[model samples]
Target: MATSVLVLGAGFGGMELATVLSDELDEAEVTLIDKGDSFVFGYSKLDVMFGREPAAAVKLPYAEFTKPGVTPLREEVTQIDPEAKRVVTDSGEHEGDHLVVALGADYDFDATPGLAEVDSEFYSVAGAEKMAAAIPEFSQGRAVIGVCGAPFKCPPAPSEAALLLNDDLISRGVRDDCEITFLMPLPSPVPPSPETSEALLAEFADRDIHFVPGARIA
Candidate 1:
C-alpha cells in the first residue's frame, strides 16, 4: 500500500508539505484539509485594506490547486488524535500513516473585552474591507494601530498598518490633521534582526509615527 499522509490546513505549510510529498513519493496519498474553500495570502489583507485590490479578487480557491498525488479537501477539522494518527473533520474521519497539522493562528477577539466592538481591524479579509470603507470618512483623528495580544498572527502587521494609514491620510490631504501610533508588546518591531528593527524605527521616526514598544492591548 502507498504511504498515506494527512495534511491539515491549506496555508503555506500544508500546501508545501503536500507538494513535497507528492513529488517525493509517486504512490503516496496526500489529503490536504482546510475549513476555508479559498486561501487568502496574509499580505493580501493589506492590499484589500489599502484599496489596491477588491476582496473578491484576492481569494484563490483550493479546488483549483493541482498536484500529482495530492488532493485538496475543503473541510473543517474538529478533532485530532495524535496517538491514533487520526483526524476528524466536518465531512468525515481520516487516518493516515503520517499526519501534519499546519492550521494557522486565529484571531482571539474575546481575549480582550470591547475588542469586537472596535471600529475596524486589518487582520482578516472582512475586517480589511470594513476598514477600506471607513478610511474615506476618517479625515482627522488619532489613528492607533495596535496588537491586542502577544504572539498574534503577523508580527509586522501593525507596522504595515501604520505606514499604509499614513500614506492614505497623506494622500487625502489630512495627514497633518491626524496622529498615527503603532503599539506592540515587543521591544521593537522585527525584534529578531537588529538591522531591520533599526530601519523600521528610522522609518517610523521619519513618518512621524509614534512607536510604543512594550505595550499590549487588553
Candidate 2:
C-alpha cells in the first residue's frame, strides 16, 4: 500500500513538496489542497505592476498541473486535527499518513492605521493592476514602501519595491522631485544575512532612498 500524504495550501512549498513526492515515490498518494484555484507567484506581482507581464498570463491554474500521483483539491480548509492526522474542508474530510501545512502568510493591514484605506498594494493581481494604473500618474511625490507586519511572507520584497520605485521615478524623469522611503519593523533589512542588509542599505544610500529601521507603519 502507498503512503497517503495530505498537503495543505498549494503555495510554493506545497507545490514543490507534492511534485517531489510524486516523482520520488511511484506508489505514494499525494493530495495538494488550497482554497484558491490558481496562484500569482510572489515576485510576479512586481512584473504585472511594472508592466513586464500581462495579468492573465501570470496566473497559473491549478487544474493544469500534470504532476503524476498528485491530486489537487481546491477547497476551503475549515478544520485541522493534527493529532488525528485529519483535515476538514468545505466539501469533504481527509485523512492521511502524513500531513504538511504550507498555508502562506497573509497581510494584516489593519495592524497599521489607515493602511487599508490607502488601497495601494502589489501583493495581489488586483492590487498590482491598481498600482499599474496609479504608479504612472506619480509625477513627483513621496512614496513609502511599508511592511505592515513583522515576519512578512517575503522579507526582501519591501526593499526591492523601494529600489525599484527609485529607478522607476528616475525613468519617469522625476527622480529629483520624488522621495522614496522604506518602512520596516526589523532593525536590519535582512537580519539573518548582514551582508545582504548592508548591500541593500548601500543601494538605498546611493539612490537617496530613506530607510526607517525599527519603525512602525502606523
* Local distance difference test values of all predictions, in order: 0.90, 0.88
Give the number of the best model, judged by lDDT: 1
Steric clash pairs (candidate 1): none
lDDT of 2 at 98: 98
Candidate 1 — worst ten consecutive residues by lDDT sum?
149-158
List candidate 1 stretches off by more than 4 Å. none
Write candidate 2's Cα lDDT for 41-122 as tens digits.
Answer: 8898888887778888899999998888899999999999999999999999999999999998777777778878999999
Q: Report the lDDT tens digits of candidate 1 across residue range 33-115.
A: 99998989999999999899999899999889998888899889999999899999998899999999999888888888888
| Cα RMSD, each candidate | 1.2, 1.5
